[model samples]
Target: MILTFCNQKGGVGKSTTLYHLARAAVASGRRVLVVDADPQGNTTEALTVDVPSDAAGVADALSDASTDTLRDVLVEGVWDGLTVAPTVGEALNAVRDEIANSHRPGWESRLRRQLEGLKDEYDLVLIDSGPALDTLSTNAFTASDGVLIVTQSTKWSLDGLALLLRTVDEVRRYYNPTLEVAGIVLNQHEALTSGGKHYAGELEAAASENSLRLLTPYIPKRAPIKDAVDFSRGLDEGDYKARPLGKLYSALLEQIMEGTGR
Candidate 1:
């Protein structure tokens, strides 16, 4: 299954969540592939330290029609069972205007066709998307089997969700008809405060009204999570099960797998 972590608004932990969840999935003896679809290359940089300037990444794959050639750009053994098709810099973004303004039919499904050739090698594939409804993000939606919406529990984020859901619906009708909403995951949750609780109530109501499943064990703001990113290490490195973020991520992984059947 291809699960894309997406939210048009940034700083909602799409990269961070993919990083932790990829680690958790690998620990469970699953062969996982991470597609860094974002132009910012946060997930690529975090995993590969520095993407080489001349390296062939997702840009080469998307720019060509040769379906089976994407594997040439795959970076293997990044972290045990995880392999990455990294997107660095703005090479892929350079074609955004042409893609948006052109009258080409079926250009939107390029990434999906390319990924379809590679889905059998891994048990799961996760994509980290940029904070925009651009060509790259639309390609990710076209390729993905399901989308996992990541957002903070706030009024502004609720508005963002509505906009993103509209885009998702468009992709479903025009691009990938089998696309499903895996779930909504609340990040940086702090339910102790009154504002947090109020937003939590709002999220619960929104999910119910929309007939969407809200995944449990919301991720909290924690130091270890930041440290893991800073030090470029997995959260489950050393006695991490004792850490709050570690336990929360494990539960979140379980919730995701259960909901998505991956």
Candidate 2:
């Protein structure tokens, strides 16, 4: 399955969620490929070490019309069973420009077609998109089988989700007709507080209104998650896997696996 972790608003944990999902997938004995379509390259940075300065990556593949295969840009073994097609921060803007200006036959569906060629090699493909509705983000939606919408338990987050869902609807209508929204992942959750409860209720209403499942076991605001991102380390390592947050992610992984049947 090709899944894109997306949200228009930043700090909604899109990159973090993708990173964890990749780790979880690897732990579950799946071969995973991650596409870092986000210009921020947070996913690329977190999962890999010593990214070569001269490597031709996802941005290069998207921006260059001559690029034919994803394997030319793939970085092998970023983790045990994880491979990455990384982005160089500034190069994605060029990809956006190419997609906008190129009057080509398959510009929008380029990523999808490329991944289709390698479908047999990976059990799951995860795309981490930028926190905006840009060309690269559109490419991600077009390329994905399903989308995992990440949001916080807040009103502003709901507004972003509305915009993102509209984009998803357009993509389904005009691009990938079978594109499914897997569910909404409420991240950095703090449901015990008064404001948290209020926003949680709001999220529940929004999900029901949109006919999206509110994915179970919301991820709480925790220090280890922050530290894992900050330290560029993984939480499923060593004793951390036994922590509450790790167990939470394990459950999240199980839910995702059940959805995808992986």
Per-model TM-score, in order, reads 0.93, 0.94
What residue pairs clash in candidate 1, if any at all? none
Error of 1 at 259 (Å): 1.7
Estimate the TM-score for candidate 2: 0.94
Name the regions of candidate 2 deviating beyond 4 angstroms: 65-68, 238-242
Report the CA-based lDDT of candidate 2 relative to the real structure: 0.83
Tell me the RMSD of model 1 versus the true structure: 2.0
Candidate 1 residues 214-243, lDDT tens each? 998888766778678766677778444425
| Candidate number with greatest TM-score | 2
Could you report the Cα RMSD, in angstroms, for every candidate shown? 2.0, 1.7
Clashes of 1: 0
lDDT of 2 by residue, 1-262 (tens): 9999999899888899888777778877899999988988788788887887666788777766556377788886456898998876577777788888987877788788778878689998999999989888889999988999999887788777778899999999999999999888999988888877899899999889988888989998877887776666557763544356766777887897688666
